[model samples]
Target chain A: MAEIKLNNLTKRWGDFIGVDDQSLHIKDREFLVLLGPSGCGKTTTMRMIAGLEEPTAGEIWIGDRMVNDDLPKDRDVAMVFQNYGLYPHMTIFDNIAYPLKVRGTDKSEIRPRVEKAAEQVELTEFLHRKPKALSGGQRQRVALARAIVRTPKVFLMDEPLSNLDAKLRVTMRAELKHLSRALQITTVYVTHDQIEAMTLADRVAVMKNGIIQQLGTPDDIYNNPANLFVAGFIGSPAMNLINGSVTDGMFVTTGGTRLVPVKSPDREKAILGVRADDMHVHEAGQGDIDVTIYAFENTGESTLLTVQWGKQRVIARGDRHLRKDQDDVVGISLNQDHLYLFDPETEDRIEM
Target chain B: MRDNTLKYLLVLPAVLVVFVTAIWPLIEAARLSFTVGRLNRPGSLDQYLGWENYLWAFFEEPAFWNSVWVTAIYTLLTVGLTTVFALGLALLLAPGGRLRSSAQALLILPFAMSPALIGVSFRFMFNPEFGLFDAFFGIVFPPLADVSWLADPQLALAVVVMADVWGWIPFLTLVLIGGLASVPRDTVEAAQVDGASGWRVFKDVTLPQLAPVLAVVVILKSIFSLKTFDQVFMLTNGGPGTATQTLSHYIYFNGMKYGQIGYSASVAWLMVIPMIFLTYAYAKFVFRKADQ
Candidate 1:
């Protein structure tokens, strides 16, 4: 296993930059995830490290060697593509054994190692079949088996679980975590799915527009977002940002009402950021602010109330048993410790 | 009417057209092979020859055997050269940028030219006195300056094979480009990342997937090479004392020029045997691919 470092790495296609100049240091045997929306350059960054793509500028050092000029085979990295990239013509056993065979491993030692890898992915019985003959999830396992069959310096996975059905994705996500931990290889996984990043990554690098917006542990990013973008992007039913201002240590809404006590100085334009779960709902007037419910959704685990606050809507996660309808008045109180303030102009967090 | 019956009814006209155009001619050829069929003799068409013509072509005629040998060599050279060159050209053009795509577009032009025209063009280009290729070759190797290209038997046959290969390469290259396009990019990338070198990636991953398309190309080219007539007829015309005469040219000579229609028909039917096997192989590849 090796540590991977990118020093001012950048990838540009003509005038359009795929990955703007960014640097990252991935620890040895750590599962670091690159998380972002589509077209946000997370996959591009992973591809650069895998040597599938060439960086326009900067050095990629795996262990101690700069691998910018090396071909992918010479880099000794194993990658699982988004499409799985299983050899459709080869048997599952052959697919798993390809990496070892190509690397000139002894012929006699191949079968046992292939069988063991297949068994790890629970694919022993399907070894004789081609990828086309297997189900989608089974094909995914073959891809994973192929990558792990050889103990390469690093493992690269690009949205490997995105193709499976939801249930299979969850199951495979747990399997991937277990396999990554068991193997203890340096892995850089890229995915747009936030939950995958939170659960699987030792440190998640949240990216946007070819830049890493936040790089930290899941709890650190979730609880204390570095910017308005991070706060708005991380949580489900995303963090509510109300257009308002801080006036005399009180956060006031744009519609001219004092909403909550704050520790910040007065500012004309700021956004109040709070998570959906942090908003406590009560009968009208029992909480900090009373508002009419714009919409209510029951997601089985919990109920979500989209409450009208001035001209903006804020979603609050209520207890699963709490029932409310449209236009129903409910009082909502923000957990003061969890509340965030951001400057509207720069979109940066304002410490309060 | 039931749906199946109506479907059969819809195909009736095509079946009739095929019967009249293809099957009837085959049956008539079979019948003609059984007779004496001499154009000069008034009653020769009706005279029963039985297996005499078949036996004569098989044993008695050295010229017929020479034509068979010539056809075999011609087919091998044309099919092998065309396929190899076309595969190379397809690989060169498959990456597809503005220049490569434009080159690919130009590839269709050679195919659009008739094979007979290609033969004439090659004959002109190889003219010993003032031809483009003749002068170029003479300049490149001065020993060729005085030699006549179409006069030597071996050189004449080579010219015919070159004409055929040239005419066929463009079409085969286009088919192979389509084949290369269908190979999965990610699988090739996977092989690369799996620690395969460039050549290994092609041999282990790309070529195996490309086998079906290559098989189809080989079979189709073999059939066409076996039946080669147009370019040979136009370029060499079985020249240099019958050294370049393929089986089709031999059949044409006996049937139309010598007026031995019966013997020619038997040889023509013999050539169809290999074609049947090739078509069967091609069909198997196509159907198996469809199943996948």
Candidate 2:
């Protein structure tokens, strides 16, 4: 397995910049995920590593070789495209055997290797069938089988599960995790699905506007976001960010009401970031702040209450047993240990 | 009022038009071939010939066989050359940037010229005294300085084939470009990442997807080549001891120049046989593609 390193990689098309100058070092046998919304340059970064796209500036090193001028065939990397990119005219057996065949492997060694790879992906029975006859998930498995048929130096996957149906996506995601663990190849996966990055990545690099906002373990990023963007982007139901000012060591809402005590010097303007699960809902006037519930939603495992806090709605997760309707007064208490304060002007987190 | 009835009814006008424009002429030609239909002798039009014209052309006429041989070689040369050159041009133009797209747009200009005009231009270009190609070839090869291209039998046929190929390449290239565009881009990229080189990707992925389109191009070009007459008429006029005479030229000479309408009609009917088979094969490919 090979480690991939990007040194100040940049990609530009005329005035439009696809990827700005950024550096990343992926360790050997590590599963690094590039996670971001559309147009965030995650796929462009992976394509550069695959030698599919030429970097406008900077160096890409795979193992010890600087593959800046290498063709895709010389890169010794296998990629699974978002559309699976299966050869529609070739059978699954030939599709998987193509890399080996093109690399000048012996004929006798091809069939057994193809069979073994197909078996790994559980596609032994569909070897003779063309990709057009297979379902989306089956085609995706064929793409995976093609990549794993030959042990390449690295594996690059660009949202390989994005095209499948929701149920099949989850099943395939689990299979992918198991397969990646079994193979232990250096993999760089790109995805916009936060759950996939959280589950599949050993370390996730969250990107925005062609820059990495945060690169850390999934737990670390979720538990301790570095900035306002990461804090708002990482959690489910998104972290609620309330605008307020820190005065007399207490955070005051814009409506001139004192909320919670924070251990920070007085600032003219600050934003408080809190996750949905961090805020506890209680009976009216029983907690820190009394607010009317704007809406209540039961999501089976937990009930979520969107309450009005100083003219802004903040979602709070309560027990599944709790039932509250709109206009119902609920007491909301901020968990001080989990609260994050940020300067409104800089949009950077202020460590308390 | 039903869907099935409405669909058939909608196609009725087209069927009637085909019958009037196509089927009627074919039936009339077949009928005229059986009679001694002479343009110069009106009284002989009703005289029953009973396949004498066909038998005469098949056995007694060496000139008819000569035309057949010339037409066969011409068709083969033009179709093969046009397809090879057009496919190469399509490959070059298919990637599509500003310069390549402009070149592609310029290709249509040659196709827009009439085949008769192209033939006339080729004749002027090969003129021995003061022609562009003649002077260039004479200067490049001094042995050909005094040679008259149109005066020689073999050279005249080659010039005719070249003219036909040049005139048809632009149209065929445009069609093949459309075919190339329809091949999935991802499949080619996938082949590249699968460790195949540039040429291998084309051979394995691009060519296989382009097979159906190439078949259409070949069949269409063959039919057009077989029916070629306008260029030959304008350029050689079946001269140089009838060296560049094709089947259509032979039929025209027999019916119009010699007034042997019945004999020409029989030869024309013989030519239609090959066209029917080609049309049937083309229809099969089109329908099979639709099924997919």
Chain A alone, TM-score for each of the models?
A: 0.98, 0.97
- What C-alpha lDDT, on a 0 to 100 scale, does residue A318 get in candidate 2? 99
Clashing pairs for predicted structure model 1, backbone only: none
Question: lDDT per residue, candidate 1, A263-297, as tens digits?
Answer: 89999998999889999999999998899999999
**lDDT of the candidates, in the order given:** 0.92, 0.93
How do the residues A298-333 of candidate 2 rate in per-residue lDDT, one tens digit apiece?
999999999988789999999999998999999999
Q: Model 1, B1-292: lDDT tens per residue?
A: 9999999999999999999998999888888888999888889888898999899999999999999999999989998999999999998899899999999999999899988899899889999877898898889999988778888999999889888888889999999999999899899999999999999998999889898999999999999999888888888899889999999999999999999988898899988889889999999988997887
Off by over 4 Å in 2: B1-6
**lDDT value, residue B138 of candidate 1:** 88
Error of 1 at A144 (Å): 1.5
> Can you list the residue pairs that collide in candidate 2?
none
Q: On a 0 to 1 DockQ scale, where is model 1?
A: 0.80
